[model samples]
Target: MNHEHKISNWDLIKNGLFGENTIFRMAISLCPAIAVTTSLKNGFLMGAAVLFVQTMVNITVSLLRNFINPRIRIPVFMLIISGWVSVTDMTMAAFAREAYRQMGLYIQLIVAFASILARAEMFANKNKVVPSMFDGIGMGLGFMFALVVISFFRELLGRGTIWGYEIVATKPLLIMLLPTGGFFAVGILMAFFNWIDIRFYGGKGAGGAGGH
Candidate 1:
């Protein structure tokens, strides 16, 4: 039905933040969502990096979509993704060296993120530059929101702190700091978000775990 044409820019943004959240809703890119979310600071940093790279990569891919050969689009996408990641890495290293040192690995890891590549293939490659940019912003912000929510709970419960400031004064759930705790936190929150979608928004529930 070509529903994409009917979707507005604001809806696109909302879709990323809620409809197809990279974590709770879409369930793609769980690795970083879980691994780096042990603390709010780390999660926020990773989210910010992904947001930048995702938006830039979408813009670049949209601009170059027609020029890219169909048979080699995957490779071209990889190149674009890596290129953006490298630029982000270098910029952060130069201007925010200390912070970059902590998040550099995660930023580089964005090169391999399925969500980014999926956007290039599924949305950016087929859309105009302006729409692509907005889509990227929506998706990036969605991912960032998910990370913040997950890390908020994880850090607060796991470490008794939020962004290093003591909140509870005692680790209410030490396991929340561990990998197992990450799974539990994500699962519980995923279900919570799903419930909200279904009950309030009449959403069908999260779609399959992929770029879409």
Candidate 2:
């Protein structure tokens, strides 16, 4: 879709949140999504870090799009992404020490996220600054939303708690906190979202994970 020419700003936001969600729809960056989502606290912290890096990277990429050489654009994008990721890393280290201790690795991992890099190449590089900023917000929020949903179920089912607060008297499914459980959660949620798309939005369904 030619989002720059045809789609409205609000639609771009919705598109990222639902139509092209990072987890349930796009399926990119599943590694971090699954890894950090075993706990609600980790999931939220990682999502927040990603949100900051993604928005800043998009804004930086959009501003530098014209000046970047086509042959070196990929490297330039990585530089921009890493720069933002480092900023987040140091900022959190100084301010949010406890959270940084929990999520420092994932924050650094944001530099390699396919979804963030894809937006820089596909959307931000071609779109104007304002739209790119909103697109970043949308994509970041979509990712954060996915992490929250997955972590919500995982934590509640596995530990019977939400953010370390007790909910159920007993663990509903202990395996839900394991890595294998992450796969199950992602798969089930992916299907659920695809069903929603087909049933309500008349969508063909979720596309392959590799494509944008």
Candidate 3:
């Protein structure tokens, strides 16, 4: 059998969004996905913010990779990421004060999100600017996709709404809004995705803690 090795941008993006998703498939970054996805809107906004952060950080990190020393690469990466996040934090505070307030410390916590760091160290550190940027877009979409999935279910069942728009009318599954419920909701979804992978892909899918 002849081996074929061809990769396209679409494949990369799709892999990041679905095949290698940080939430369902990879199971990484569930904390933010679960914590902030109280509503569909909140989940969307959080995803947007993360997407912006990831793209900028990836580009910048890739640009500076050669300049950073191995001994202090992590700290340097943190500084760069935190600086960008601070800018984003301030921008949000100034323009979207309500959202800023809604996000609170979580916005600041973006600097420490392992997803961003992982991209910096793994992909951005070695890849060129364009590829790093694409990676950011892919990973960001994946992260957002996961958040939206979890939030969609949580909102519909927990509040009878989607993106604050009334969908189902009932008392609602109030537990979905609580912290414990977040875990259960996301866990069940993850298991389902895994099960699907096992059935269709022979159990060979991208396996990791999802997020480091």
Instruction: Give the TM-scores of the predictions, in the order they appear.
Output: 0.93, 0.94, 0.89
Better of 1 and 2 by TM-score: 2
Give the lDDT of residue 151 in candidate 2. 98
How much is 41 displaced in model 3, in angstroms?
Answer: 0.5
Which of the two, 1 or 3, has more lDDT? 1
Clashes per candidate (backbone, < 3 Å): 0, 0, 4
Q: lDDT by residue for model 2 over 1-212, one digit each (tens)?
A: 36465777787788788878988887899999888998998898888888888888889998988999989999999999999999989998999898778778888889899999999999899987888998998899899999999999999999999999999999999999899999999999999987877788777778633333
Candidate with better lDDT, 2 vs 3: 2
Evaluated against the true structure, the overall lDDT of model 3 is 0.81
Q: What is the per-residue lDDT of model 1 for residues 1-212, given as tens digits with 9 covering 90 to 100?
A: 26786788898888788877888876889998988998898898788889999999999999999899999999999999999999988988898787777777878889999999999999999988888899999999999999999999999999999999998878899999898999998999998887877788776667533333
TM-score of 2: 0.94
Arranged by lDDT with the best first, the candidates are 2, 1, 3
* Best candidate (score: TM-score): 2
Q: For candidate 3, which ten residues in a row score worst on lDDT?
A: 1-10
How well is each residue in 99-148 modelled by candidate 3, as lDDT tens digits? 67888678788888988898789878887777778878888898888888
